[model samples]
Target: MAFGIFDFLSLIGALGLFIFGMKVMSDSIQKVAGNKLREILEAMTSNRLLGVLTGVLITTMVQSSSATTVMVVSFVNAGLLSLIQSIGVIMGANVGTTVTGWLISQLGLGKFSIASMCLPIIAIGFPMMFSSREKLKLWGEVLLGFAILFLGLNFMKEAVGGLQNEELLSFVKNVDYAGQPYIKQFFIVLLFVAIGTVLTIVVQSSSAAMALTLVMCNEGWISFPLAAAIILGENIGTTITANLAALIGNVHAKRAARAHFVFNVFGVLWMLAVFPFFVNLIAGASVDIFGADPMKTATGIPAALALFHTSFNILNLLILVGFVGFIAKVVIKMVPSRSEDDEVFSLDYIGSGMMETPELSILEARKEVVKFADIVRRAFKYVPRLVTEMDEKKLRYYTDQLEKYEDITDRMELEISSYLSKAAKGELSSNGGHQVRSMLNIANYLERIGDIYLEISRNLTMRKKKKAYFTQEMRDRVAEIAALVKKSLDLMVENLEAYERDIDFAKAEELENEIDETYKRLRKEYIKKVESGKFQVRSGVYYSDLISELERIGDHVLGVTESLKKDNELIVEE
Candidate 1:
């Protein structure tokens, strides 16, 4: 108990080792399980029941409920998973997290050396620490991680056990909250909450807090009632990571974080309300079930901790699931969906996106790319309206909006360009690396299309201001080119997300070729009219630019198709 400064540093060194091992282990485990994670979460809904289930399953796999919730938030932001479905995922994640407690309970926390001999666990693991291969180094870190996790726990137990010889025993034996009445215990709960929150934020791992809880309980330093309260507090505090991530995220993402905070807060409140009653109830159950005697010293602390985690999450889910829709509604109201009128484009996935994982990031970036492609579709959408309307004011308004759409494309190009740049800094698989390239290519062509739209909008605005008129033949020719380009842009955007799922792209290829031929034919017809002197050169100016703009947009479509073709070739190479 009279440890010196050197002893304290030794303990700090042990704790740091524990954290390093945990990180290595979590990373390796996730890489092993990564392929299956996405498939499981793909169709997760907004309802509470399914939400809870998704959360549980994901938490069980990742072994961290907080990680599961963060993934759900990222999914919701990407427009893959909606906010409503995300609520359920959050609830389920909380429930799923209890399995960790269950796992911890099942772990033979007191065992390990037999398997170590044949493996010479340290021999294999130590060299791996110095290995040149990155993957092996990661794997070695994982093995050494397991070694160090146990090593630190061993150190902690020995250190704490050493305290049993001194005045620390008398200090530990006292029911420190003895003088604390309801008001006192209430403040004590606040203290535990603060402890849990700070520990989780500092360590950035909920499991570490749980591990610390286990250590404290094992040391007989904290009563079961207080430990359980701290356990619940850990759940709430663990959410701070995601909440921080969501601060700069989209509305849906922010809602996902809000739901996490709400879920944890409700769970903690419910537990606090029934604290003493449940403490006695679980203690009584332990008495009969485990032959535990509360009259004497009981070491069923681990079981008690596990019970509190599971029952609390289950209870919280049962009560809060129904209100999930309302949670979504509240979040939506608080963080309204971005409208085109409000911003250049909806940045639903930028910072809040779960796209940090190479696989998921590629998917999210593709969605934004798809949205950008749709800008070209909107340009196409405007063509018919432009041709059908005769009012100068109406035409001008449409042109102005078209200019706005073009501006949106400019912003989107920059947004996605920046997003992909950040995304590329991580280690990318060959496919992911290529998708990054393809995405950059898409943005470039898209920006060009936007530029073309700007030119067309400027010409249209000029003609409207000049009060110039075009004959019916001229209008028909321009409309024909616009309609063709519109079709190509539609197919191009659709192919972006749909490329893999779409088996028969021959028709898409055929249509792309048709658009190519149509642009050439239109160009010929425009010049014919100009040569006949039937079309004024000044009138031909705007008409010629419109045709060129339409042609270039069509070319971008073909470029997209070619890129898809190239992506396939690369896939083949891989």
Candidate 2:
């Protein structure tokens, strides 16, 4: 029978359905268990072996290795996981992904019609998905997605079986390279391996590729060995998702993805070297131990292939587990760190598609805010240096640092605020929601503080360009106010850092009072000096602007401390 356009469309539609169902199921599950997944990943990936276990658990729970590895890359980008730990997790993801093939073997090939089985599931899930309650709605989606996944598989199986390409089968069986079985078989394996890799890359999902491979095998369109070779290629192809995710990330993220690629490629290389032996071992175990019949290729082949997938990953993991350090080092060398790696103004912990875990995203936002505070502190410190520097070159250098810092802080505030806003729209507790508002306010105040720093730099630049010389008395008084402003900023960051802990709110209030008093005293003293002809009136004008901006910075810092105090109280009440 000829493969026609209708059959081809049916096949493509089935594949599309399968991919859609996978995304729905994976996303719904993540919505249901995102916070718990975050906690488990954050806590469990502390060491190499534990990281592997965490990877397996998360991939199995979410039913998507690509998701797990992408999350791992995000975590590494966020500085949540080290390179070695990420490698371990990547290894476990490979093993955990094999679970999908086994599940298909059990569910897709049963005596009952998998497609028909999906009807009741969708029937039951449809109403719940649109229900008023969010919890029930999420669960309903999971059920609907499960039904759709298997329904697609059922369609694919039927469509593939309908191909009736007996000529193709005959061609595969009759192909020989001058009667050299080994050479012919080797080329066959290599050809299918390339096919598998391309299929996975096109779909961007190894589980999908594995399902298609199993379906093809179930129809005896390909032998089990060829299917296993495809599985090997799928492993290599699966790394693409994480690597693609890492493209917008930092050096550490790039290294983590490279480690994943390195690990899978190495596993494939070794498996290729021992290809025949590996296949035979898995084949023997499937027949003798798992009750699968080796002579029967069509009936028991999927399970045998599943067994091959599992065993290959497990053995590969065992071989590479001990060399995680070496792998990490190699990837680090491969992806060298750039100066901007540490200085780039982007969110490290939060990324796109992470709003599902709102509470967790808050934590990420807070981490970014902490980094923001540090940058502001550095920017503020340079203000005084710029004020005192008389050398043109030094003044320009300090001014540029302040300008860069202002831009960084501005971007950081926007990024963190945008993340929080998105996360706030998700399911969150009242306290979590309130904390988001408070964090937003804090980011706003921090941005204001950054603006004030930039303003100070501008004023200093203007004074330097005008060649305005301050009286010794005016300079000394303004320095005192600037010092007090620095103290206030320091207290503000401290309160934020120890948020939810019993903080010394009074100390922050004290710094604010000091800033206020210093500004007032300096303003009065400088005005008197100008009136008494001890300082130039132009000098007093610039000095007053400087002290006023310093006072404004103090005000914003106090605002941050106040927000932190409220946020802390809410945490305590909860």
Candidate 3:
């Protein structure tokens, strides 16, 4: 019964299979009910109680709390969920995750152990994968995932059972001291806690970690209390996945991940203070409820382990639920918001998001576009102010701000384009691809509008530097053109935001034509002013730059509108 390299590799391979099964199963479930899941999560997580319930329900259905937390983080990143709402869901996810332990208790350790049922399930599932019907194929995938998951667990259990390594067992047993019981117990618990944390981090799935712990306990490799300590560490380890996901996210997203870590670590902290007593309680409950002593292998410890996992989370939630606001405040302090002007560099959403599902990815991309449009609108609003400011200091301030806005738009376009390019690699419907292409084109146009603003800002800077200012009439004409371009931009955004339905497009075309006519008329009038010596040539040149940039911005805005209109039509045909 030697634990050789092949045995170790088999164990690692088994863990990989378990993780793979979890992924496949989780993804299929999401695909089967992704829209409904979104609707439920959005509609149900409005309050603390509903949010908790939504978390529990979603985690239980998907059989993975990590998936639920990642989704919640994605929602926050997408502006679909607030930080507070996310906190509530995260708390409930802690409770929901225990369901996996209970499932293993029944399926992996009972008379109908998962090991015994894996092949029959796979036999039933294998034919489903080949079904022409999409729904049947998805169902087949789910069944196969279940079978593979159990097979992996069984392989791991068998591998550990074969490792009757006396040296390892002796070290585990020697930690207890007869004269100093509390000291000995404390150190052992801490050691197991560290072990559990490392194990969960390496596996990246608490469910798999829990399964392995149960297998070790079932084989008498660890005591029930020791397993309980490891389980506590698993709670802390599970938070790492969400935190890793939040790295590319905005401040709010980072805060949500921090909140998750805070919640779990607090749960583990309090549990450690009363470790022995709590384990005893769970061990007693296992015997009373299941007619089996958890410490004895023949009676089964999986039930006791599951009970402990559930009770600990439930009690932890009850104790800390009232302080969610306090916890949120703490995380906010840990990660504060950026200063006003400094905050304009990056996109606010779609960071650390799940792009495995193209449908959801597209929705996130659209939100980023909406944010992009709003930035462009704000930048345009500053145009007339830039022109009218007479104080040199204020004029310089305005131009500098506009320049920053242009840089912001450029960064946003690049980041979002990169995101969409990755999303395009995922499976998508024809309509989905069309929508993505349109979003890319719209981003390009919006970026061009930002360039136009920069151009206008530079012209104003030149005018200010040369002591050449617009005459009242010239200012009035320029303002008129700016107002028309502003109108076109607003219309473009409206079309972009409601890109699912049919847009008039006629109104947008009319606006574009009017802008062109106005530009021609303004050019003619300004040239006459230059010829009559009513306007300085240098002033006319700057005026021509401003007017031409405004007209081109109108054209780009129109391009965005047309792209939206075309995308909407394609969606309609679908």
RMSD, one per candidate, in order: 13.6, 11.0, 12.6
Model 1, 167-284: lDDT tens per residue? 5446544656645788887777677767777777777778777776666676777777777777877887888988887875666688788878877887788778888787778778
Query: What would the per-residue lDDT of candidate 2 be over residues 429-534, giving only the tens digit for each residue?
Result: 9888888999899899999888887888898888877878776666677778888887877777777787777578999889899889888887787778788988
- TM-score winner between 1 and 3, please give it: 3
Q: What is the overall TM-score of model 3 with all chains considered together?
A: 0.66
lDDT for residue 157 in candidate 2, whole number 0-100: 92
Structural similarity to truth (TM-score) of each candidate:
0.60, 0.66, 0.66
Which regions of candidate 3 deviate over 4 angstroms? Answer: 166-169, 177-180, 296-299, 341-574
Error of 2 at 430 (Å): 34
In Å, residue 253's CA in model 3 sits off its true spot by 0.9
- List the candidate numbers ranked by TM-score, top first: 3, 2, 1
- List where candidate 2 sits over 4 angstroms from the true fold: 110-113, 166-184, 294-296, 343-574
Best-to-worst order by lDDT is: 3, 2, 1
Give all candidates' CA lDDT scores.
0.70, 0.81, 0.83
